[model samples]
Target: MAELMEQSLLAMREGAQATRDTGAACDRIGSAFDDMRSAAERLVDTAAEISTFVAAIDALAQQTNLLALNATIEAARAGEAGRGFSVVATEVKALSTQTRKVTDDIRQHISGLQAHVTALVETANGVGARLDDSRNATERANRHIQDVEGAVERNTASMDMIAGLIAGQKDATVKLEEGIASTLTHVSASEIFANEVVGAVSATDSVVKAQFASLEAFEIKNYVLHRAKSDHTLWKKRLAGMMAGLEGLRVDELVDHHSCRLGKWYDHVADPVLRNHPDFRALVKPHEEVHVRGREAAKRYADGDLVAARAAFEAMNVASTEVLMRLDRLIAAFQ
Candidate 1:
């Protein structure tokens, strides 16, 4: 009886040691998961920085492309002296295209890396859940041993289950290590591509600058037109500023800025030129008339004729419906 008891005690001690080993393995796996999560966060931050830099580069490239196009057109117009500038412009335009391609590549790769990291995070969560189950199983086995002094059949079966759990965990930990390592390798490649894009952007400056510096005032106007393409957001903002002044019947700030902008639109942009259709001309006439009236209203506000200014604003609102109707036709055609 004494010898049997010693053997039983020995088995329990061995079981305890195995449980400790399993717990230690879980701890190490948890640490590795934390490290991987940290690395993925760093990659996210780096990708964001790259995105910001790429936006700046995109704006620079667009300006360069536009300026180059104007240079090419004027070279055609120049008929002779422009031949050299035309060649230079073509080269700069090609560089801008190349820069766009590189930025696109970087964006695509970084997006893929983000998806990859998300998967890694999901896997980490799964590992954590599995670890929780493992800890519970270990604890249950310890409690069973304490509750009973010795019972060969039941305790042995429980020991077998714990042993299997530990073995399974070893395999899971190996897989987690491999997965994290693979994701890291992909992130490294994306980082390298991002760096390459940065280098290409740096190379574009000299050519872009040289091409832009060569343009005269007239050619610069072409760039201005390219940039001023119909943007209702800017139009709305300017109109709102003007209305803010007009609404309060305060024309002091309006004369210099918002009023001047409207006047310029009337003076240059909305100049009644030959239209493709007589109907088109008729359609736009109301807006032109209303704009003229709005400016007159602004002047009345400046002269302290508040009633006349408010009535003119009311008329302008009615005419804006005509303008929007014309816009709706254009929008339908474009779509």
Candidate 2:
């Protein structure tokens, strides 16, 4: 039981460390996305500038067309003597018409490109926002884990104190037994000491029970795995909600494997023999794949690739099943 408490505390600390690393990774990702969005914005601005330049060319084309029309009219008034000028004016007007058509085509293409660039910016911003939210959630989880670690430490101290007291009582009881038949007065004192020993034993049993109960309440293996499965389910549901136009769903809220309860337990398996168990070793790969696939699904969905998102989600489900199966086997081993 003491060993288990120590392992749990170690796991919580390791989990906290994982969260900090995750937070750092999130910051890096957010920075990259910010750079990407900025570049996209710059592209949008460049597109706008190109569109403005095209518009100016379009206006110039229209003005040239008008001037060519006036030239054609003047050449017609001059009749046969201006025939050459009339032909030149007609060619100029045709050229201007082609110029306007070409400018219109360029403007249309620019508009489409600009629209796509703006959408890219929006997507990047959305990703960054979600990352920030995830980071904040991770930090909160880390703080809570730290609190749990502190509590476990205090409980360990209390358990150690109780164990020491129990040991002292055992020693006293041994000495009392050695002199039990020496004298009546000694026997009487032994009786009182035996009563005291019984009370101490009872108290020790209560303390042990209480400590075990507290550990049981953690529901270690099965409970952690069950909650992990539930967390994944909730993540998928929230992602689906977001895809369905629901508000307040953030893909970043989905935690990575290491920051999860099961992950923590797996990382800090203090029992060397258990750590080498086949099921325990196999569990990590599937567990990690589950989180990876889940994140991929969320990212694909966020990027508006519904088909890919569904495929990734299906993969995640498969991995999650494997994870649960392995976890079950591992739990059975523990039992």
Candidate 3:
């Protein structure tokens, strides 16, 4: 009876040890399943993030296509003036098409990955949940795994936005380069036109100077006689008539004013002749009497003689016309 009791106790101990070992194995398997479930969940989350990113990329590609189409239409409408812009617009369209293709490929790949991840997560969940019921330690580890998966998903989204911004910036740079090239071409053409204008203006100036230099030299004796008739004799007659028209004519008053007016006429004649024909200097007197006999005539006009003023005005007009005619003839000989 003692031996039988001892054998029964040994059997019981062996059975308890087997159950403990089996429980430990189940615990390890649960832990492994939890790890696999977490990995599969993370993979699924990654695929979902990639799908969202790909969708966004597709949307952007659609927008780019619309923009490229608009640019192409605008360029075409501009005709020959926008030939350079048309080329750029064509390039933009090609790039947009290529981007659409890439986005489609990405979307297809992400969809496949998401399907695979979903299957894996389902399998892992089944195994982990069964193991967790068998052992409580696996539940704690599963929670920690889920936290890591969430962090990875958020980071992926941020990276997608950055990539889109970079692509947009590249397109802008291409347009800028095309605009600068067009501006340079326009500036080059303008410079050529400006040079042509300068050449034309220089030729015109040369022609004008040549024409001015064709003046003939006048004889000193003829030039002096012409000045004496126009400035002295003709001007004296005009002054005398003006004096007679005035009511309160005085000889002294006429001499003072008439002398200065006559002097101005002499000076006008002398200046041009002296400068152009220095040989005529011998004909000009240093102290000539410009007033002549007009003092008494001018005095009559100064004394409020209206008839003398009218006669003087008429005489001055006639003499001025004769002088101008002589100048015209001399200028015509030069031409």
lDDT of each: 0.64, 0.80, 0.59
Runs with alpha carbons beyond 4 Å of true place in candidate 3? 1-8, 132-335
Summarize candidate 2's per-residue lDDT along 243-316 as a digit string, tens digits. 54543344677778898777887787788888888988888898888888878877888788988988987888
The backbone clash count of each candidate, in order, is 0, 0, 19
Per-residue alpha-carbon lDDT of model 1 for 1-335, expressed as tens digits?
33455577677777877877877787788788778877877877887788889888888989999999999999999988989999999999999999888888887887888788778877877887887778778777767765553565456666767777888899899999999999999999988896676557545655554554565344443342222222222332334445545223333433422243333343354434323434344545665655656666677766777688677767766765665565555334434
Q: What does the lDDT read for residue 322 in candidate 3?
A: 50
Off by over 4 Å in 1: 149-335
TM-score of 1: 0.42
Q: Estimate candidate 1's alpha-carbon lDDT, on a 0 to 1 scale.
A: 0.64
Pairwise TM-score winner, candidates 1 and 3: 1
What lDDT score is found at residue 168 in candidate 1? 87
Better of 1 and 2 by lDDT: 2
Clashing residue pairs in candidate 2 (N, C-alpha, C atoms within 3 angstroms): none
